[model samples]
Target chain A: MATLEIHDLHVSVEAENGPREILKGVDLTVKQGETHAIMGPNGSGKSTLAYSLAGHPKYTITGGTVTLDGEDVLAMSVDERARAGVFLAMQYPVEVPGVSVSNFLRTSATAIRGEAPKLRTWVKEVKGAMERLNMDPAFAERNVNEGFSGGEKKRHEILQLELLKPKIAILDETDSGLDVDALRQVSEGVNRVRETGEVGTLLITHYTRILRYIKPDFVHVFSGGRIVESGGAELADKLESEGYEAYQTKGGVTA
Target chain B: MADNTPAGSTTDGAIQVGGPQQPIDARVSAPASYDVADFPVPHGREEEWRFTPLERLRGLHDGTAVANGGGVKVEVSAPAGVTVETVGRDDARLGRSGKPVDRVAAQAYTSFEKASVVSIPKDAVLTEPVTISVHGEGGVAFGHQVIEVGAFAEAVVVLDHTGDTTLAANVEFLVGDGAKLTVVSVQDWDATAVHAAQHTALIGRDASFKSVIVTFGGDLVRLHPRVVYGAPGGEAELYGLYFTDKGQHQEHRLFVDHDTPHCRSNVAYKGALQGKDAHAVWIGDVLIRAEAEGTDTYELNRNLVLTDGARVDSVPNLEIETGEIVGAGHASATGRFDDEQLFYLMARGIPADEARRLVVRGFFAELVQQIGIPELEERLIAKIEAELEASVA
Candidate 1:
């Protein structure tokens, strides 16, 4: 059974000319433990999909049903959807100064788990997770995503995922603005998620850099408000060379 | 040494030595004149006290009919998630010694409007410091403040006295047991205000009290801070900072009483007086009771007169009734800002305003950082910037 199912999802924003459609009926799905990568051009409504799924107040969902493990996901609150195992690693992580990263992650973990744990055990668990992700343990005590480099923000998101252990994680262009070393660290963190049994992922990116480490089981192409084509890993290669022109053609695969 | 002799005393003429060279003039015992009835203030009956112009004291007291009104009333122009409320349900006697604050004297100002208050629930661990502004922009602004730090509770309270223009204000604080409270009060008024405020605290056992007061404005401002340690195992820290420019007069008076055993008290007040005839004073007194065995007491007052015409007078007083106390000491000095700290921040490419802000933040950071509330701390940083602009902008 599919872990996540997106059916005819449409989104728009209230702009000067009225509802300017951003996502024009995109549909896709992923089964349990499978990783799917969505490759798109700029302004292709890629980040919109991530925001709409996370229930950010900015993105308006004009139509669609988003289900996670057969549960209706779109009807939940932002934090509720978060608690329901839908995680979005934001491309531009907000700088929440004064709120320490450790404090934020711990609170998030507690909120997700629905109970409080011992401080000693919580610290140990956090230490172990940071070690697995190669993050400085002191970063946890620093303010949340505040004063962090681009790479550090990405790593901090991964740390949260590790600590919270969400069922399905969405990486919104996490590959952007990363150096080779930072990219490797991030890919390793994602790979750890995949190895932890039954964890589903949706990697949204403009570049295929991260795909080199965490191979996607399926690849979907998004353009002009819809999914133009879907296939195996070769689809990524074909688009890489031909540059999405073939997918724009009228005869392109419409599903 | 002769230097340790009592002020205005003749050591050789004493009929009998009470203890040592220090005069034991029974007639000149420590003055307990701060009681509600006899305390000397501008409320009534005096001429040297005629300095309080009615225009300045306009709304300082309730008319002949009503009891004293207490509560720091503030109607915020912004609808943020903060509200000002009274300290408790008892409406009449909100820390006035039941004397309606009007008859108690020493008030150059009182609230014309009804009093306002804020309450943090019992055992409520409010991580953020609750900032209360006794904002008096134009008219005479007189208000009261009552704070209750519940049992086993911990909180940080920030009171900022400021105005769009010149103004005056009064505030009071009451704290409860096994509870910890830290208050940071910054006064940034227009150059014309004559600000006079008083703070009284009654602390219980196992509780900690901390206060940082920074005074930056007022033509003539006086602060009287009194604290009474009502039980054992209590700790109190008092700190003050004042920067005066151009004919500003700021004074701070402290009275810390260690009435029981195993108590600790410390006081530090520093200031910089600049411009022609600018003046500042630090008057502090710590009292150790007969039963205050194993008590530790310390006091320090330092001042810097920046310009040749500016002046500062600091006085630290300590009276020990028991020899069994572990420590009792006092220090006072009046002097300019640290040129080194300013140069360091400037060399780091920080602009003058930002550098000034950093210096100011660091100067107060010892207490500001101790505030555990993330959101409140952020707001405090912003408030500090706003005050700096008002003063220097």
Candidate 2:
């Protein structure tokens, strides 16, 4: 079964002066068939944790061991880790002008699976996936993220998540730039993947709107580079009622 | 410094032309003045050929462009419903209505068949592109061609330059007003071929013309595509790509002129160079005239040098008078594979080589997609894949 394990991970980015730590000693684990949510205020290292896990060049890992089913995750290349079942739904999917969504999806699929899928089966699967997410088939032929509205880019990333069938998916603010309709469509896409029992979801965001659709089994309050508090899904509900102002004041400086 | 001296005459009364041969007596040649015979060799005497390289013409007849093993041959089979007219240099059909400039008095092989003119009638919309195939398997052959698209007509032309032998070809195009013409030229010559080609285009008012050249073959290939608008509302776009490897020299020189008011033109060319002696050159010149008010023009030339041995030279120029009657600008830059863009792709699950390929592919993929033709784009990708395979070999 697929599993994600992040242990004492410290992340930092290059600042004007020098390296400024963003994620400090953050630790979390989510086994297959479970969805976990990470919520925090701005600069609380939520997105940093997600990007570091995805192997973005900008974020450097100070110290940590990210494992997938006991495999050394940090040691794998970004694509290798992806092959090993890690997927990241980026906050801002880059607008690649000429690469169509269909081409990108097919390439990504071939990349993750190590070969091209049978045309009939793959076409059917892609069509079904789009229909389930309330996405039009025409969306597949459009250029990847080019000329796409904010919500469209986010949904497109989810479409990739559905097609690649990754075991572990880190949704980095999937709900940040979506209208109500787009938010529901994105959440539904995440839920459909969970329903298949083939993927695990790591929802990273500050909003509680998406949690209403893809309920998280556990909610972690990320304060500094580390998770300061962890609890049941009620914690997300609590944060939805009360803001992150107090959490930022409590241990934010140390973060 | 004699006031009585003619424009090109030296005090010796002999015209000293700065070309391959030494000064020729202007008096003996002036009155009769340049029969096509006078242009046995191309020198830098004429304005159009001022910046041209005379060294390239050193092997005119003596240094034959040897054909690849078994020899090379050229054949032109255009799509049906598209009429093809073959004209020989002696046919007098390829001559311009205006004064003839004996720049590179081209010699299209009789076996090479002077040139062919393809015509797409007015208002005729062609679904398939006209495929012109050139085969060079024997010795060397050079070709000259002229194409005309009638007003309100739409057509695509595919010029496939393939040679098992060496070849140098020149192509020229003229599009009538309000016609839409798309020209996709592919150069997949044998690596043994040394290719030097020139293409000129004149776009009439409201005419939409696009020229795309995919360079991959030949020991060395130099292509120049020039476009000048006839009047306001005319449009022209030039897109080019070249992938060169060691022992191969590929260069592209492009000129887009907004000669009339309200004309628009855009040009973008990207290339990748690899191997120990691979070289790529790009010169983009956009000239806007003072009277060409309210014209819009932009140009960009980008190059990618994949390895240490590869080299790229890029130059983007913009010439505009003090009058700012329109929007005009130009940009040019050469970059190796960006470590960050690569890392980003790799992080998303693409391997290093594949990542570089994808980014490089993505680098030019944008332009290929923007091209109105799809099959030619596939042909381009396939040609690049051949380069990849050869490099690996």
Candidate 3:
């Protein structure tokens, strides 16, 4: 089992004016087999937390302590963090030209597993996972996200999440741009991995529609670059009814 | 500066006498000739020689270098029903496709003792490719080769160059009416070698010609591949891939002359440069004459700069004399590695080195696929991987 701990995380980005802090002393903890939904409005620093933990290089960690099973996650490189079982499903997955989906997946699997997967079984494993997401078998031969549609890109991300089976998976806006059907399919994929009981999922989103499918063990209201309230699933229902206006009026800066 | 001095006394006199005296067509100013004296000795000032380093030619441009016999061994292997012969320069079929437009090519034309001619009979389809291997033996050499495909014949030919030598040669392709020909010319020379060659193809009525030029070696290599249509309804496709390493100069200049109506042509060349002082030059010129109506042509050049101090000069020139063409367009781009692409691959647990390799390989994958030969494609991919291994180390 794996556990991730983020304490007093402070992140900043270089804007045109100067250095501007985004994540202001945020704290969170996620253990294996636990699902945590970080709910927030626009510009609430939710995605900043995802990219910072994944070592995006664009985000500067001014002050923070991130540890994965007592190992210093903040000190690791982007790829090193990935090899250490930290996966980030980006909101807008980059388009890598000329690299086929199959090759990318196999290369990633090799790096994570420390050896090449058995060819016969690996092919079947990929085919099975892709089928679960209703992906076409021919999609394996296409370039990774080169010309895929929005829904297709989301499904591809979930496909990787299912196959890689990282210890901690951060899904950033996976529900954005996805239709109702795609949302249900992608959520089903997350739930399937959740049932494995060996992975911790940090699903960051602005809507509570996804929480209806994948129930979160805890709901955290993110405002002003920090979590101002934490509660059970009932809190999500309350936010869905009352909206984030109350928090914004209660001294929570817009960004 | 004495006006009474003899006209041919100074070194610049030769350039003045051989160069175009008056303003001529910008597309092709120098007239094609068979004699070396008709063309000027390039002093790196002419438009064609601006990007080339004349000092590295090893006397190929001027008349100083003599042919050291046996410098290069030419071997030809062909399937049944095909004829391969080493005929003298007087062979009536030689130089029928195009004339020598440069001094080095003209010198090669006049100096080569023997010319290899490969002929395919009419309507004969070749199952196996005709392979011509030119192995350099470390000297100055000149060569000429002719590949003639008869009417309605279909054939594929592979011209492979290797080893070390300062070589200049001319290769001609004659496609008969309704014939289909594909040529794969590879320049995989030694690191210290110098090479200059001109490849010309004359497409016949309703015929098709495809050329894949792959260059990966040689200290200084320059290739000029030109295409001309013999009659209407001809089609030509030119695809090239080159890898320029440290201190290497690889240049590819292409010209497609659409002199006949209803002719179509497409050109695409991609290159990757690595290490310091690595230089790559690509010049694509397409010309559609006044009488050539309904002409369609497009040219594209893309270069991936892999490291610092590497340089790429890509120029695409299109001159259309007729307004009744279907379409004409060109594009050229030279860029370093895409950071977001690298980040995407690395974010999936791939190390930096492997990610770099993937991007470079992906950049050239399109042109490599145009080879249409599985074994050759695999070999080229392996060669690219080996090139990456060096820089990574």
lDDT of 2 by residue, B1-393 (tens): 332111221111111112313211121112221133434444555423433344544353233343233434445666666779877666654633121222232332222445688878888888877878877664655666777788888888888877655455557677778999898888787887766666777787799999988888877677778777765688888998888888677878776766678888889887877777677777776766666778788887776666666666566656664265557777765655545545545645667777656646666777777775767778777777767766733
Off by over 4 Å in 1: A248-255, B1-210, B213-393
Q: Could you list the iRMS of every candidate?
A: 16.5, 2.7, 1.2
Spell out the clash pairs found in candidate 3: none
Give per-residue CA lDDT, model 3, range B1-393, as digits (tens). Answer: 342111221211011112233322353436788888888787887878888898988999988878999679999999999999999989999989888878888889989999999999999999899999999999989999999999999999999999999889999999999999999998999999898999999999999999999899999999999999999999999999999999999999898988999999999999888778888889887777778899999888887776667778787777777788899888876666655667777788999899888778888887888767788799889988887887654
- Candidate 2 local lDDT, A54-158, one digit each (tens): 887788888888998999988877888888888989887775434567777777788888999889999998899888777789998786666788988887888
Give the DockQ (C-alpha) for candidate 1.
0.01
Instruction: Give each model a TM-score.
Output: 0.49, 0.64, 0.80
Residue A39 CA displacement from its true place in model 1, Å: 0.3
User: By lDDT, highest first, what's the ranking?
Assistant: 3, 2, 1
Best to worst by TM-score, what's the order?
3, 2, 1
TM score of chain A per candidate: 0.94, 0.96, 0.98
Regions of model 2 farther than 4 Å from truth: A14-18, A249-255, B1-197, B200-212, B217-221, B226-240, B244-251, B254-348, B355-380, B390-393
**Positional deviation of residue A82's Cα in model 1 after best superposition, in angstroms:** 1.2
Reference-based lDDT, residue A77, model 3: 87
* Share of native interface contacts present in candidate 2: 0.43
Docking class of 2: acceptable
